[model samples]
Target: MAEINMRQAISDALWEEMERDEKVFIMGEEVGVWGGTYAVTKGFYDHFGAKRVKDTPIAEAAIVGAGIGAALVGLRPVAELMTINFAFVAMDHIVNEAPKLHTMFGGQMKVPLVIRTAGGGGRQLGATHSQTPDAIFAHFPGLKVVSPGTPADAKGLLKAAIRDDDPVLYIEHAAMYQVKGEVPTGDFTVPIGVSKVQREGSDVTIVSYCRGLQLSMLAAEQLAVEGISAEVVDLRSLRPLDMGPVIESFKKTNRAVVVEEGWPSYGVGAEVSTRLYEEAFDYADAPIKRVGQKEVPLPYNRELEQSALPQVADVIAAVKEVL
Candidate 1:
């Protein structure tokens, strides 16, 4: 067993993958010299050298385009986009090229690429830089989306994403980088398209991912004090969403509170709520409640930013209401 933070776990995943597979290389802006925008690739420059850790210009499209091209040629390229808010600049390559290469070419080629970026609004990076548009990426077909909450999932999911033969959008929460958790040291990889039940309860089920899962866990602890047992189901993979565990949890709890950091409308929670109604409507005792961001441009002020996101209190109240 190894105790590590999400950042370290990701670094470890990158290091191990590159060591295991020579085809696996990293390319992005400031990835090598600056050690990545979040220091996730801190020592990669020295260990992997400039060849394996090829830093490129500031153009996100070029970074993504180059990654796709490399993947088509049998290289497993892990491209970094600094922050996911910048993904829009590279959507041409992400949505058009990477996802289409495999099928567009009649299955003759494989685009085994992974684009990694971070999201979340707690840091007050403002509207331009602070956005959690996970559902936006997951909305597209042929792209695997992964947003892990704990260190174990972070390491496991990243490994799986790199190994997968399709393009993956790996969104990490900015706030979770320093959050520490126990992770396996030896060979381990959590399969993509699965959900993990973080806590067992019967009153209400809290379905969330990334930082939202942390908030749900916090709310669960408080709910326990009030005799309301709220189960926490962490949706580790967003696109290939493991709806099975969510259905099972809702069936047992009879109530659900869908939580996410993205906008409420057309969000992951909305999809989950709809599915719960479709597959497990009879099991639900009350209408599902959802908690998400305030749907406005993220504010730069710390107080406004904090108020804009779903908080522990919001989850608690929602759980109480659904229960």
Candidate 2:
């Protein structure tokens, strides 16, 4: 196995998928000659040619609408919105058309489209470019929402999304693109809707996904030094969320803390807390605690942004309170 960054892993997946399936093509802003805004598709235009690797105008709704049309006609189109914030422009097409076409039409159509976008704050991209809006898509009934925390998961889940017969919202954290991890040489796919226990423990469980998974892992390491063994569960897919592992972990650990970077009110963490209460209330030794972004609009100042999001100290404190 060779280690690589999240960006490289995603590029590899796209390259391999284009080679494996002629129907798979990529179109987005700066995806061709510019090699993508974050360089995830570097050199793709040269390998696949301009027709397959297209650079679109700065119109998210049109990009997504074209993707939906292509997917409905039997092509697998991976449409990229430069950032998740811009995805708001395409919500109508994504929620109304891409996810509903097949089921609403009684299985007469298939939209095997993959919508890839960068999300999260940490680079001072300001409030407009830094919002994590996966919660909105996850709320919709027919869409598949995926957020990968590592290089391997980024590669595996993207490949899986490209192959699936439904619309998949593949979100990549902006900060995690440079993080490196070991990735297998051969092709592999991590099933959607499966939660992964990153660290095994017995005292408490920390559930999170995407960049929050990294934060929880760091918190787990710090907690271990203080003799608290915390299990970290990464809910890779928000929609079709896999709560079995979460329930099982709570049954063993008896204490749980959910970490999410999104705002607390009706956020993914809130849903996780609700699910825990619904299925694992009796197993919990203490009430489930949720650590998420402050219930306010993210500020532009760097310090304020940092304060609004969850940190290792916050996770440690939340875990302590839950225990």
Candidate 3:
């Protein structure tokens, strides 16, 4: 086992996948010489050469459109948007062309494309760059959405996304890029639509993913000091969400708290709460609690930004309330 940062793990997954499949290529703004905005693709250009690791113009729509075209022709293209916020500019290509192409064509064509982007707030990136739009992509019928919380999951899920036959939205939280964790040396993949229990407990279940997953784990640790054991479930894949683990955890804990960085309105937490109510309402000893960002735009000021997002203290408070 090797300890690596989340960004490095993702870079390794891309490099290995490109080597394994000639159809796999990476094209995006600053991906070639810049090595990606977060340096996740550092040294990729020199290692894979210019053709396989290309630098595209500043147009996000063009970048995604080109990737979709390449996928239609049997190429696996990994398109990187500097931030998930810019994905709005390429929504038509993603929602209309990329996700819908194969179904629209009656399975005559396949779009094996992976769109990787950095999302979420915590570094004072401001409202423009801090939006967590994973829920928007998860709403689409044909697209698969993945958000990995740890270095191991980041590497494994990226490999699976690259090898999938349909479009995959691989979201990386900006705050977790530098987080370090143990990652295996050999190739491996975590299946999509699976939930992972980061910590097991018998008191309460906390469901979260991405950076929120890390926050929930911290909150769980603190809760343990108070004799309240909190089970944390990381929903790695938002779209094809695996709620079985969550339900099982609820059965053991009899309580749940869903956490997310997005706004409460139409957020991922809301969906998780709905599923809990639908499947395990009778088994629940307490009402499902949801902790999410306040229903307001993220502010540029540091204090205000902190207030806009969910924190460990907030998750702890939610768990306490549920308990």
| Model 3 quality (TM-score) | 0.98
Q: What would the per-residue lDDT of candidate 1 be over residues 156-262, giving only the tens digit for each residue?
A: 99999999999999999988889999999886798999998999998889999998999999999998998888889999998888899999999898999999999
lDDT per residue as tens, model 3, 199-243: 999999999999899999999999999998999999999988999
Note the residue pairs that clash in candidate 2.
none
The stretch of ten residues in a row with the least summed lDDT in candidate 3 is 121-130
Q: In order, what lDDT does every prediction score?
A: 0.92, 0.92, 0.92
Per-residue lDDT of 72 in model 2:
88
In model 1, the clashing pairs are none
State the number of backbone clashes in model 2.
Answer: 0
Against the correct fold, how does model 2 do in TM-score?
Answer: 0.99
Each model's TM-score, in the order given?
0.98, 0.99, 0.98
> lDDT tens digits, residues 97-150, model 2?
888998998999999999999899877777788788778889998999999998
- Model 1 misplaced regions, further than 4 Å: none
Candidate 3 RMSD to the correct structure: 0.8
For candidate 3, give the lDDT of residue 10: 97
Question: What residue runs in model 2 are displaced by over 4 Å at the alpha carbon?
Answer: none
